[model samples]
Target: METCLCPLTRSFRPDFVLIRQHAFGMAENEDFRHLVIGMQYAGLPSVNSLESIYNFCDKPWVFAQMVTIFKTLGGEKFPLIEQTYYPNHREMVGGRLGL
Candidate 1:
């Protein structure tokens, strides 16, 4: 049997929810999306709403801001290296799409 990426069929429903997702990349999967959708369908109050997480993950500049915040907040100081990491996402996409 093929496993469904997002399983909406839940045996139990919860009254409250607290979503402490450290990494937004996890939301890229349809399974996570479906789980969030299911939670919403059940009318549960999530601390960090799935929509908010999705929005944060979808924005490319968020990571750049995070890097800035990290450096400002004593994350690390590297010599002879750029403080922020802005990947060439366009190049990556072009390579993948053969553009």
Candidate 2:
């Protein structure tokens, strides 16, 4: 994502159409909204908010580090994988079993 952004922004001056396409691809999952909200509340600057949040916490930093590494290694080579387990897995299981 970062690699694509660097080149795309350079060529297109951060075109909204292209940015939306890229953003849509990244934000496909429902939980992404949480991350977006968290970042917004973190009070970091817009452009570097992600990096700032990463630097603010160990867990966030680890996540950001993984993403940076993934981006550097090329998103194509290490494509994003959707988790088979849902975030509300335990709740779903409990409801199903009438627990």
Candidate 3:
């Protein structure tokens, strides 16, 4: 935190800030929001701004929005995603999964 503030108070300030904290709850999210707000107050741009982070964390349908954006941005031809659980002896042999 001090490291982030030192540069802000000095003559050189970052043009943009990228906040990549894992905020789980209101308290954590608010903390991150305040950080982003502080950066904006310092006349800087912030990636994943407070509002965006809130929507992303709180909204249940955010993934659908991302999928829409992906398709809109020419990702419609992308392959479908498949998830498989581990410890399946049928798929694993000799400690290696059949890929």
Residue 3's C-alpha lDDT in candidate 1?
86
Which numbered prediction scores highest in TM-score against the true structure? Answer: 1
The lDDT for every candidate, in the order shown, is: 0.58, 0.43, 0.54
lDDT of 2 at 49: 45
lDDT per residue as tens, model 2, 30-80? 233345455456543454445443344433334555667677887788765
Residues 17-82 of candidate 1: C-alpha lDDT, one tens digit per residue: 887763346445533656677777777887787666555654445555555666676545522233
- lDDT (Cα, 0-100) at 85 in candidate 3: 30
Model 3 agreement with the true structure over 1-99: per-residue lDDT tens digits: 345545445466777767676434566335454555566567677676755754555433455565566666654565334333335576545455321
The candidates, ranked best first by TM-score, are 1, 3, 2
Query: Where is the poorest 10-residue window by lDDT in model 2?
Result: 15-24
Candidate 2: Cα lDDT at 52: 41
Cα deviation of 41 in candidate 1 (Å)? Answer: 2.5
TM-scores, in order shown? 0.41, 0.22, 0.35
Q: lDDT rank, highest first?
A: 1, 3, 2
